[model samples]
Target chain A: MSFAHFSELLEHIRARRSPRRLAVVAADDPHALEAVLDAVRDGVVEPILIGDAAAIAILLRRLGERPDRFRIEDVADPTAAARRAVALVHVGEVDLLMKGRLETATLMHVVVDRSSRLRTARVMSHLAVLEIPTYHKLLAITDVALNLAPDVEQKHQITLNAVEALAAMGVVRPKVAVMAAAEELNPKHLDSLDAAELKRRSLAGDLPGCLVEGPISYDLAIDREAVTLKRYASPVAGDADLLVVPGLTAGNLLVKALMFSAGAKFAGLVLGAKVPVVMTSRSSTALDKQMSIVLAAAATRELVHG
Target chain B: MSFAHFSELLEHIRARRSPRRLAVVAADDPHALEAVLDAVRDGVVEPILIGDAAAIAILLRRLGERPDRFRIEDVADPTAAARRAVALVHVGEVDLLMKGRLETATLMHVVVDRSSRLRTARVMSHLAVLEIPTYHKLLAITDVALNLAPDVEQKHQITLNAVEALAAMGVVRPKVAVMAAAEELNPKHLDSLDAAELKRRSLAGDLPGCLVEGPISYDLAIDREAVTLKRYASPVAGDADLLVVPGLTAGNLLVKALMFSAGAKFAGLVLGAKVPVVMTSRSSTALDKQMSIVLAAAATRELVHG
Candidate 1:
């Protein structure tokens, strides 16, 4: 039941019985309000706006929407909004949390605080689901925005978080490609060694419900022609559902190249928390923000809440 | 005189009065021969094919070309062919070297050997000249194939190599972006630290003939909208001529994404040597291979030989 496109994910979410409750921290943000309005109009999410109530109302009115129709909390301070959103997650009031025009660090600190109740045993990581025009289906890339230089163990946890999140989204047995420079285990390259070790762990069933293959190059992972040409034998080759980049720099560069150069549409979410978090960048398009909200709503159904 | 596209580069080389002599190691490769034939027909290059003369002749005949029309050195073994190619470069017989049907390690070993006399004071690095549809002009990415995790000094050399090569090809004062996950100096991320150091060096005139900016992310480097959206201040921000990656993994991922997902046409060459070396990947299209030859030839005329 994997999604081939964002439209499919949107449709899948809309078909659900009821809209999920979403907490929009710093909800005074116009861009966030626009996306939330679209999601609400689509019957995908019921938003609990937590920010400067007066500002939110004004912005909502400016957009030709009635602010009185939605619930609004007057937490004017950005940190307070973030704290309130996390508090909602603690009391089973919100199924997901979203950052809105606030400093990401301000929201992230509250979300990952020891007392934030949104903390899960697994380390939180960012997952970006991209709709590349050239690809056959939706591809999920991980930790592009979060982990700086994740080691083997951190990457292991990151992989599990993505695999579980994708599974929750109806992707059965996601094929994961632990990306490296090339598809060979070179002693000189720690990335290749890390990839090989992850593969070994996958084989040991440490990373269950996923087929992990690596030290795979980008060409071998996505291009079947390259698989056939290089004669690289792996199930994950040419049909990767997930790409776990070696570090943040690689993943960030890859995603930007896809967006700016490849003309890809993407939706990003922060996983490994008690609830999924939507933190789209300011540069993200309206479509990207809408798709992210839809994706968050879709992934929210089976995930654990307070 | 910077090239806007690979066609412009081809035109630039074809406009030259005399064609540069190119030595193709293990020249029996069909793809290599096809590209060479195209370059020859375009009057851009005079190829000195060094490989098993029998196989080279057979391949030439198979491709509907005459073997007798071109000079073929009958070096039977791949290592011997690589050695002979390096020897030609030593005595100034050829202005450029192109790898054909041989292990890259074999050719690279010969080219980098102290006795081979191809080594320069600077570390040899691989540069990919990409003609992306979305970009305004050709973008050069460095060290995607050669250096693994280059230190700041090595990266300095790598950047110098790319800047010099682009300058030779008529790109004046190339704008270089030292890529990172974000455009901030973070103590935790060595990539960011390295980028800042490089920028500092560039400011001190250590990296002459280029505008080096860094601790910059991909979106800011290539997308003007992102630059405005983020309010990132840099001249190189929306119009980078070169991208120097933190390491091989990041660069390789970036280049592959541009190639496979972005539908970019690219040609690769090894720089910092006495002469530019064409070493296109097996998966490169014919245009890419031919463009590599053209690029090598254009770069060769201004580079040191003998």
Candidate 2:
């Protein structure tokens, strides 16, 4: 099944047989706690808050929740909290991992630690699902938060991570558009060359789960009118479920432009790990965090079943 | 004299004491002729159509214009028309060169030909002026249509070309934001390193006539709320007149996104030549082309007088 909106993702997660447990690292942040409380209330996820139990309870109570109503761990330090959360995931106690008030580097360091048992052979990549008002359906963009200047091989890995995550979310065959300045392959443009190679690899079944088209401009990738005007025909053209940007700068700008300028709503996760990791900015709204939790829940269900 | 809108640019050119003459190469395209006709009607420019006189007349007649209303040169071949336009500029017969039905490379080949008198000591770069609804004033993006992957030196030249063009358009000292993925400098991100060097050079007077800030993200560069939230203080922050993107891919995507997704109106020109060249896409609207002509007219006046 294909999701037309992020709300549908939330509804799908709500309809699951049981709520997936989330081990939230450094959960003392008010914004994160509020989202967790809402998800818990909506029967989306069961939360295991891994920060200072006293602080989490106070923040939860300030939102009019009873102190003892939710599970909480009294790890006062941020680093210790992250370690505990990772440990919970390692022992199969939690279905998902979340970053709360703690610094992403602090939590990610432990999560990727060899002894932590959370690291996978695959590279970790950030996958953002954007609900753009102008787009026909939710669009996924990858490596906007990580991978500064990914090479061709790393791009392959990044593409796989996003494709697999979307697959888990019921987009069985997502169309991926590897974007560049223009659709034509030019030797001077490394991005275009990489895109062409990626497209070739995708067609050869190197990337099995999605249809990939590349060396395409941003307008042709997402706008049907532009594709028609330019006479550029491809299955991914004008209907891309995922946009694999050339680099971090392009991806960062594209995602931020959609969110801050075009009024796009988004949820992001760090994939390619043992489990989906919900990592959002502290300034993000509670609704944004809740959507991320829902997305994570769905990915977790797929990981367990697939 | 920082104008807040493209209409101000149009009005500025219309108010000039004398209209600038434009030699439009391969001038049989309906879109290009329509825009040129509008500019002529507005008294912003005088046109010398240099393509097949018969085809030009037919298009003019279709647009309800008389065949004898404008000067027409019958160079039927695209290459010959481009050469003729370049020759007209070389001998100071026309104030600007405009591309009509010909491919961009066809015209640019003649414009940058070393044997051609239109070639200047400076490198040519595309300058786009975007009137985004959310922006406070016209935002100029550089090298969007030229210089695919400009190095640091080429970037410096591109930035200079845009700053000089904006200065000619009455912006005494244009504030340029050299864009990157993040505000902080990182060794891993070459754009950031280049941005830092450009900023240093701007401060050291290598890039004069502009206030430069860089290693800055798109949000903090244009959004005051983001600047305030991120605590990024700079004269160019939130009020940048020009955004020098890292390369062509980033710049092209940015300008196109502003146009197609953000409902922005735009005008573009090729600068750092003997004369400003109007080289808009054939698919561009009449208004877009007309604005580009106005911009080129303004730049021509500055080139002659400054």
Candidate 3:
């Protein structure tokens, strides 16, 4: 019941009994609208577009779509549009929230605001699912975009956020590799020490629904050939479903290297909120955006049901 | 005058008027001997093999080489071999050092010992040169295997060490990218702050022989398309000769990713000593080890002549 590719996630969302509602803040972006239209045509999600109505309509026309075919709300300013989108999620009108052509900080600022009902006690973290050509299945990495220099406690929350997201994708009991420079515990390496603590917590059943091992290196974590060559033994050695990085920098560099250099396609979303938030980079491909929406819809089912 | 590939580095070393003498500490490993023999056949280096004479002879014969063809010194233990290797360099008997069948910490311990004359006032750093298929030229990363969690002062030394190594490879003024998670200067990210300070110091003429740009992400640092897409302005944006990573973890993960996933070929050496030290990984390919020897030989010229 695990997703081997992003297209599988799309198929899972489409198989749902009804389409989930998605609130895309600042939806005037042509690239974002194109992804939305593809999802709409596939019946992945019902869109509630919140942005400049005139721009969205003109862009829709450019795509040869009727302006009145979908729901569009006009909010001129970016901040106001984000607030309106957050409000939609607060009242249970929208199952998911998305950021389109808007500053991620702008949307995140309102999503985490204390006054906003969307704010939960859980810490918000970003989860990215990558389809690497060399890997056997989809790989998930957490806090690549959010939570800079997260502490041990924050890392615990981030690990749980990614674990839950993976579970929602039908990956039961995912194997998580808490990565570091080396496998040994060195006092000078903060990441290694943090990884040891996280592994301890997971072993104690504190972080449930995942098998955690660390401080493992990247080669030992993913490459079976390396595991055999190095004689390193672990259940998660060559089959890690999730990689919980030490900080934002390592995760950011790892994912970008995978995409630009290693030929990987990825979809990312903000987890631990009341609803899954799709806040992809503007430089992301249209297929990436479409996959993010699909992933959000699938994760939303887990949030609403549980 | 610049090396765009590892084969070019090999040719540069082969073209040297005199082959640099390299002291191979604990040289009994078959893989290490295979690489050393390749370098010897190409007249890149004259190796002083220091290890168990019986084992070295057997390995040489296994490779179809005559035992009397090269100099072989018998040392039973790893620590003693490392000390003997350092003493050879201290007395100017050897121009470079190479590690074989010995722990890097053991060799580095003797290299940095105060009593060892090979020790200098400069900080020791590990520099790795990767010939990434997607990159334009040879990419150098600093402190990948050494200097864990270096402070601002130590980072300055590491940067200078890498710059000097590049200069030895005939890059007169190398472009160095001080990589971080993002380009913006955020207070929460310590690496970004350190990158900013390093950039400021480099501009103020503190770090000469290199143009330093910092607080940059991986995408903007190495990818020209990403640099143009984001419009990040810097002379080193897409054409970095050296990348000074924040710590050993980030650099280690990055190079390992490029090798395992991106099909990159790499060579590495330990810089900031009296002699260039080749301490490649045991799992490294024969070509990687050969390139390391070539790089060490090319870099030894600068150390000896400067």
Candidate 4:
């Protein structure tokens, strides 16, 4: 069954036989470690902290946790810590990866390295899952934090990645709304044109496991009254499970607006990787980071169960 | 003083000594007439209805009002009604225009017609003003419904138009935030590049009467905590008055997300015309339409007083 709230994901993960292994690269970051510890207390994840051991121990002790209570990998340098995290993934010692105090580029560099076994054939894309109070169900927005200005091909890949990730979370045949400024296919707006093409491909069974609707405005996508008022007929209208934004700019703005202005709680991860990657911004709240850990663990459980 | 809420705009307009004449093109539409009637009751505008006279009279009677209570221009054809509205503007018989049953393109065609005498030297753009509960003050987002994928030069023009519109609303030297996916100046995202250039030009005194900050994310633009967390130093951060979007897609999505998800109340008008135009969508709430009328009347009062 699909989850409606982020809290539901924690229950789903906890029902599993045991906690999933999570590797925190450059794990001395205070906020990241706090979230990891919160998830550990929630009995969802068994985190392997990879960073400066002294720093991690100091942070853990400062938080009133014993250093010997958790696994700590001593890799002082951020790049080496990223490599160590990737190695743990390759050896099947970790089920997922989370970025900590290190720069995202450093961690991503190790993941995408030619020799790294973590690279998947699919293009890696970020998927943000938001629990917006105004929306009836959890909504997923894609490529918000990654893929600056993806073209049609990249958007196609991103859609595939999101669909697969959603499937792993038990949301079969999710309704996907390819977002644009308006419902009409205006030639001046490439987003509308791309949306039409994506919908066509979806109808032809090219993009699978999702009922895709396109060139739909945000109001029509989430507001049932708007759907009725505008006379827009689509199964996805006002009940979209996934919203594929035109680009990162729109996606980022939409996600943050919901979180900051609409009081939405969010958790996001990088999909299309061999393992889900928790890459929330440094400015993200502690609860958001904890939710990401729970989401990663839940997705991992689904994959293993299958 | 600038308006912090739409209700304040009504006060500003009602304070005026005389009501301004408003021309409603193709005014047989019920919702449009309802809003016009509301404004009339509020004593902000004297509306001249230009459309099918018999249908307008029937609608007025249905709404429990007499047709002769207001001036009625008997132009049945939508195109001819648009022309008549522009002609009234040319002769200074009306202070503003509002779209009714006719297509926007038809009204825009007449307004931009070479002989229409209503075209201004500036590029016409749509400005949406929102009063979000989470934000301390009103925020304005631009070019959501008008410009599609504006280039750097067009963005510069759009910013100028927004600045002028804000000034007319008593917002002097407003803080303008050029929105991007992230605060960093990334070359791959042309929005960031354009934002950097806009900031440079603003600092160089090319764009005047505003404090411009660019390459700023939505969170930093409106969230004080995010600004402190990210250590982003900008006067506009967390207190932006105007948010200049990268293009129409982002702007539309941003505005709709705030209105639909964040519970924001919004009113918008088309600037750069000889008179402000209330061009809200057909599905816009009656309250929004009424507020747009109030906004237009207040802006007209400001212009006359200046």
Candidate 5:
């Protein structure tokens, strides 16, 4: 029952009893192919690769894998490939969605179309599970890649989005630390006010599903020594389960820095959608793509796709 | 002369023929005292430690140091101690200023008092020189520890503040990349627009003291390979001397993550308040504090403090 590694989470997914299918939108990307291949090898989920058939075959060969062994939907147009993948999920052909070599917006656009069954009233957010070598546990940074400038209400929804996902990942009663410039509100700081408001909402159950506390700095959120020095008390202090950034820029910069400077391994996916979507960056490594698949698969099973 | 190691910077501060006297405002923190003592031992500065006499004596004794060897001013009241430190700088008792055992706002309040003679039209900001092991050279992150929610005009001031500080430290015509989530303006993302505006202002001579370019992400800002993939064209893309973040939270999180997770050696100082205020966080290592002192001393001779 103790999940020290994501591999353990994968084992949970495999013994999950009901097998889940993942629809890969624009699967022509070599990196994407490698990841799905890795997932297939690990038996995480079954894949329905949707893209140009000839291109997928060429990529599979280059990756030293057989072409005809898997289901390949032949859609030439990239946008059409994305729509087809979304349709697969809608028609119950797949239980999960993924962004492949094609544009993220293209796939996301199709996924969020109100006419499509994938539309969810919840605000979409990005959840990045980062394993920094120095940290004792994984740090979950939210809304970093999605929801550019979330207002107080949007952040409320974003918090709910992350808390639930984190809970589903077995983070019981996740300690949410809303990161701001300082640990106290200075009236002039809108972010601090927003954080304080979110904390109030969490207490009042308006932003339910987590132990939310804020107007806290990253130092207080992660470092127990700083907490002792500052004399700040919060469940998230020195042991944050999820970090709720005020805006996208802060989230993006922090995650990118971890990846670039700290050798932090990242697995991020889009939440608050009808189904969890793997929105890996175009330049993401094969490992990143593979990890995103594992994450998306796990998150989707805990969402509407469940 | 090129400054490679911190020791070289330390030696440069020592060998600079005319070392500027630094006024330490309310020096009492253990970390702060240890740092000032180290700087004094290195002979890079002539320090004027002003604080409560009893506390200072106890602090020095704790550090295996004797308090009476240098000029020590006894101002028991913490508030008055800040005032005395400012007055010392005003009356030419010291050329540079350092903060110890006081909140930044309390010290900054006196430093920018209209009657204090430390205030100017230029806005004050914090600059950090991060010596990350992964990085090939020293990285400057601006407005990281100060200036929350900076607008376009305030950001201009922040940029100017960093440029001036870096220029004083001998980075003539430093490459300044205004970092954002992405390279292009996505109308929804304000940091991108702010970066583009900053670049435009630099092009129009409204912003001087550095080669400014932006709407750039962290990868392209430091890593050369990212530049090739993103196809971004800027000298600062791969070799930025300074990274101007969008706001305080972004800067704080970026630098904190850089220091804590990435193992970056960092030195922080408050700039633009008539003098370079040597300030280090409690989490800042002793080497970081000493580095800040060396930086402050090396920069004091320039247009910064004197």
Candidate 6:
């Protein structure tokens, strides 16, 4: 079922008649433990914490979390913990993977390992879903933390991934804004050229599931006044839900700018993988981490179990 | 001459005794003409309209304007009208140039011509000043519209250009946030690498007149909580007045996102030219144009004619 507010997703996870099992890799870090503990208490997820059992137990007790109520997977080595998390997902033991204290590259390496069950034909990329108080709809930015330098084909999949995720979250047909310097192809600016090409692909049915318009500047995409005053004509001009940036640099800067300047609330996840992955930034608050888990659970429910 | 509030600049422009000379090229476009007329009525400027005189007369009459009240330079050709606008600025006849019905590149070509007085040793770039109600201080974004692909040296110049303009508007030392994808130098992302180098250059006085920090992602640069929580150290972190982007695409999207999603009011001008220039998009409202005129007048009064 499509969801309107993130709270609706929280409701679904809470009921979890068939709970979405989330495996935490190297779940020894205090912050990571705190987040999962909160999730478990909320009853939105069934946890399979994979790491040093003793350390996790001590940290959980410090936070007043009881161990008898939760599932613990003790793996001494951090790498082994990562391997076990992926192994759980591969064998259909878990529905999602949450990175804990381990480094991202290490966890990602194991998740994408050809021998792992989480491997998929499509490349993995990060997607950030933002909730700005000023915007009427949620703002979706892709490949901000992952897929550093994606080419045209990778970008194509990235767009599809975000659209599907949003569609699964209740957006019937997300208006995709292909961001660029100008709404025309300029050789000196490769992004604009790429934006134009992407629009063509979307229109030609190469990229299904959404409406895409590109080679368009930022203002024309989201501001109805800008579109009307500037005489800009595009169906996706004022009501865009997903913004497909030209590259990681633009996506990263765009998402962070809104959060920092406008006090926007956000949740991020890795998509196009075999399973939904939760990977919040280190700077994210406890609240932010909670929101991300909620987001991942909702996305997983919509995509895999729906 | 520096201003802390946008209203302060507006009041100063409203008080100017000698109205600044404004040359309007191809003065037949409805939106462009409306903005120019509004500026004239506000006494912020005195315009010399150049285009098809008959068409302009009709447009003015339709707007209930006194057709013969202002100077009308009849040029049947739009390209020639654009050239005249630049020529007037070159010859000290006008303080700023505005594009009326013509294309932006046409006016830029004449301004950049070596033979024109509008050409200067310093490179020209675009500067957008935002008066967002939610924030305490005005936010300035540079190199958003022009400079498709700027290198490190060009970015340094962009920083200096923004600082000078903001200083003219009353910021003593504009805290400049050099934005990139990540908060640290990752060898793979060139923007972050360049940001690190730019910061070093600022310390060495190469990018003089501003506090520069980069490889600093958007959130770390503007969000105080994110800064304190993440422990990212830099004066620019929570107190940036200006944001210098790595390229046009990132910068353009940022300004748009803020305006559309955050309800920001903005005014922009072309900097590093011989004179302050108003380069509003053809679709801009009269208020946007009037605000741009006020900004240009104040910057001109302080930077060029002080």
Least accurate 10 contiguous residues by lDDT in model 6 chain B: B297-306
DockQ of every predicted complex = 0.88, 0.63, 0.77, 0.89, 0.71, 0.61
lDDT of 5 by residue, B1-306 (tens): 335556766776677666668777777778888888888878877888788778888888889987887678888666798788777777666767888888867877788788888877988888888888887778888888667778889999988988777776677888899999988787877888999999999999999878988888998898888788768788888888889999888888898888777888888788887678897766677889889988887766543434
Q: How close to the true structure is residue B228 of candidate 4, measured as C-alpha lDDT?
A: 91
lDDT of 4 by residue, A185-277 (tens): 888888999999999999999998999999899999999999998899999999999999988888989998999999999999988778999
The clash count for each model shown is 0, 0, 0, 0, 0, 6
lDDT of 4 by residue, B1-306 (tens): 466777876776677656779999999999999999999998988999999999999999998999888899999999999989888877778889999998888998888787887878888888888989888888889988888888999899989988887776678899999999888888788999999999999999999999999989999999999999889999999999999998888888999999999999889998888898988788888998998888777656434532
lDDT accuracy of residue A238 in candidate 5: 87
Interface RMSD of candidate number 4: 0.8
**Per-model CA lDDT versus the true structure:** 0.90, 0.86, 0.87, 0.88, 0.81, 0.79
Candidate 2 per-residue lDDT, tens place, B1-306, comes to: 787888888888778757888999999999999999999988888899999999999999999999897899999999999888888876767888899999888888888888777767788899998888877888888878888878999999999888877877788898898999888888888899999999999999999998999988888788898778777789999888888888888777777777777778889999988889999885687889999998888776534542
- lDDT tens readout by residue for model 3, A72-181: 99997988998898888767788888898889888888888877777677889999989988888888888898887889999999999888878876789999999998
| Highest-DockQ candidate | 4
Recovered share of real interface contacts in candidate 2: 0.49
Docking model 4 quality class: high
Candidate scoring better on TM-score of 2 and 5: 2
Docking class of 1: high
Better of 3 and 5 by lDDT: 3
CAPRI-style quality class for the chain A–B interface of candidate 5: medium
Question: Clashing pairs in model 5?
Answer: none
Ranking by lDDT: 1, 4, 3, 2, 5, 6
Write candidate 6's Cα lDDT for A137-237 as tens digits. Answer: 56777877788768888888888888877775556778888888778778888777778888899889998889899978777777777788778898999
Which runs of model 5 end up more than 4 angstroms from their true locations? A1-4, A229-231, A302-306, B1-5, B61-66, B302-306
lDDT of 5 at A46: 84
User: Which pairs of residues have clashing backbones in candidate 1?
Assistant: none
